[model samples]
Target: MTKGLDLHFPHQTGFLSLTAAAVSHQFVNEAKNWTEAQSHCRSHYTDLATLYNTDDVNALTQLGSPTGSAWIGLYDDLIDSWRWSITNSSFYGPGETEFRNWNVPQEPNNAFGQELCAHMQSDGTWNDLPCASAFINFVCYGGNDQYVLINQGRTWNDAQSYCRANYIDLPSIRNATENEKVQVVANGNNVWIGLYRTRTWSDGSDSSFRHWNSSQPDNLNGQQHCTAMSFSDAGQWTDEDCATTLPFFCYIADRPTVVTLRAVVDAADELTEAEIEETILKPLREELIRNGLPNSTSLRLRKVYQTNP
Candidate 1:
């Protein structure tokens, strides 16, 4: 539904049809904290580098040959990170998705940053733990308040897959009543719930691709929430403290662009098309420059057609 940036003037509306910008990585040898590096990237180029696959990872390795690790865009979202495997928002009611019954102060402590998934205790209170390490019995909800507790053990992801294939999904404890029902299914043992969290990127990209080093993202001391790719480690990723200053990589779109805009204008019969283009291009160019488009970057209005709204 949405195209590129749309520009609006007092008597004119313009639709910016931007050809995709070819993204590239840039390495900054200067050391700075994760937040500071992000600010620098936004000010100078695009946001921090976000790798989606091995190809993208390999591309960053070719940048200015250097040593030491550098920050990328990935980071652990410590707040409001828990989510259900059944991601359909319609499955939940008002305040239902936000419901949590953790065992409190010590439960989701993320001890060493390894506890990204949650399981329910015998008492119905939840605790976060490593999803893969714990192969435990899981509960599956089959709608209409039906909960099935399977005796077989499986990892959280596996359980989610199994439940999705067989039932609705892994159980979602929306309230104490639902919790009690699911807790009863547990029959006095910890069982996997649908609650889990995942890290995010600075540019808000939702690519699930990950290339962490062995046993990385350990969230050491619970302070390592930022991610960095170690050149010495074959561009593998690891989580570090957000405040730790380090050289970082930034991405910018370097390829040329040709924009086709559909503009509507109301003007005196004497006005020329060039004048209309100038008036619209001035603000459009300013917006582009303010958003980190290089000054030397070529910008031209390929075609401006008058269309009936």
Candidate 2:
């Protein structure tokens, strides 16, 4: 009887199916060059996609469909350095070791000078190539905050000026969320933000208020005082002095409220609109009326919008 009896079992395939669905949804493919790819990823999909670990990369590989090369949001121009195109920080896990394919000396001989471009090979390893090379198909990721996209394509100084004229201050990173948000927006290109250590906030003199992720403000072997954001390292901040001539980030406070007529026109009318404001409006109005006008003869009654209360 026991041998003939059947037992019910839970279907485990559902979980695998769900995982496959998720992997399929996160993959993206587009055709373009480095700049064009960046633009397409930022505009159509997400600003910058994140590669947290090997699993994420694997998921992306699966989503790539038909098994061909695609451009990822990662690259480095300096040396054998690797960084995320969004934050420009070196925070990717060790899993990337299995995915890297160095050309010969395993680093940048700077052979062609600035020929720094990384591409995903069919074998799933990354390789450096000349940026001028045309390629098709790019992958994108989701999960980034909505930030102001400044496509200045200008040098760092000009970019700073543009940010200042339009916003409150250059971009600032208070926490990881903001960092990721910026990274996602920039995707795979270098951008600027509002953080630097040129002048000390305390005395307006050099006091070294530089904040960095690791041995940063490393100045990379020099005393770099200004800072700029790189898409290579997950938006991690670094200082390189103000004269480095890189893009900058600016942060604008919310729009200010427009002045109202009633707010400007006070009881005394003695204090000019400039003098009386929200805090000082009533007090100055009272004080002016109490003190009275210095030159009564000079005062002329203008047409009143409302009868004097």
Candidate 3:
């Protein structure tokens, strides 16, 4: 019977324990505008801080414990950000979400930087307007492509609530055909659609989680487009002017690096390196996975200098 081989590894095996990527935060007390702060973060660390969950938010809050507010990574993009209220991607066909029929060059000029909501014109063209604009009618969509025009004037948010409570949501005009259908329902009066825009993270994370104070993100004075965390307010977030100078937080992550292990093993005299890999290394990897190693991790032998050492 062949006896078991006693193996020794010179370096850390990474396989014995899980290696997780750690994220840390750095607070720069120097005041800078949002853009400038973002530049500093990218230059020095990973990027402006992006809080994903309660844990992340709490960690950041505890890390800084700052005396005042600081810039984060979120910002409102006024262009190319229109989206439907019905966000289930499975409901949209190919290219459905990209549909738009703006009046072009003139419409959606974001007159006061507060034109975050979209509306349909009497001629079926689209325009951007402040969400709180009064006396605007809206259209609601039921399943099976059915649309209902509500003549009662309501703000964009109210209209959205009404539609959600009654129908599936505000109409998502996917193409000229759908746009014409909505226009026909309006019967020559302007109406609201589901299309609207919102803020996004600098790191391109699609997380929709937000921590805002009461009556926050008012887009105050139509100029507040950048986000900041107010440590004094229990780490709640608020939108501020992008040009406002404020201390900021940056996110940092450890770079992934290979942890190589020099393994010494005793095996049968006839065993080859490939045989050792198949008999010993393969089972070792399987055991590591069973213990807690991530499945995405890869293992391989770079080279074998000696058969038995």
The candidate scoring highest on TM-score is 1
Model 2 residue 244 CA deviation (Å) reads: 27
TM-score of model number 3: 0.60
- Residue 158's lDDT within candidate 3 is 97
* Worst ten in a row by lDDT for model 3: 10-19
Per-residue C-alpha lDDT of model 1 across residues 84-152, encoded as one tens digit per residue: 777555677999998999999888988877788999999999999888954689999888999998988
Which rank order by TM-score, best down to worst? 1, 3, 2
Q: Which stretches of candidate 1 lie over 4 Å from their true place?
A: 1-21, 253-309
In order, the Cα lDDT scores of the candidates are 0.78, 0.34, 0.76
What is candidate 3's lDDT per residue for 1-309, written digit by digit as tens? 212333653321122222334567898888999999999999999999887556667767787755689999989876646778776556779999999899997987666556789999999999999999888999999879899989899999899889977777888888889999999989999999998887888876555568988867777777888999998888889989999999999988776435555555544343333355456666766565566653323455555544423
Sorted on lDDT, highest at the top, how do the candidates line up?
A: 1, 3, 2
How displaced is residue 281 in candidate 1, in Å? Answer: 37
Compare candidates 2 and 3 on lDDT and give the better one: 3
Residues 1-309 of candidate 2: C-alpha lDDT, one tens digit per residue: 011211121211100000001111233444444344445545554423333234334444454544333444332222223333322123234443223333346542333322334433333333454444433222222223335656444533444445544543234343545555555655554444432212222111111222234645444443343333334443444545333333221111122222112222334333221122223423433343355421110111122232333
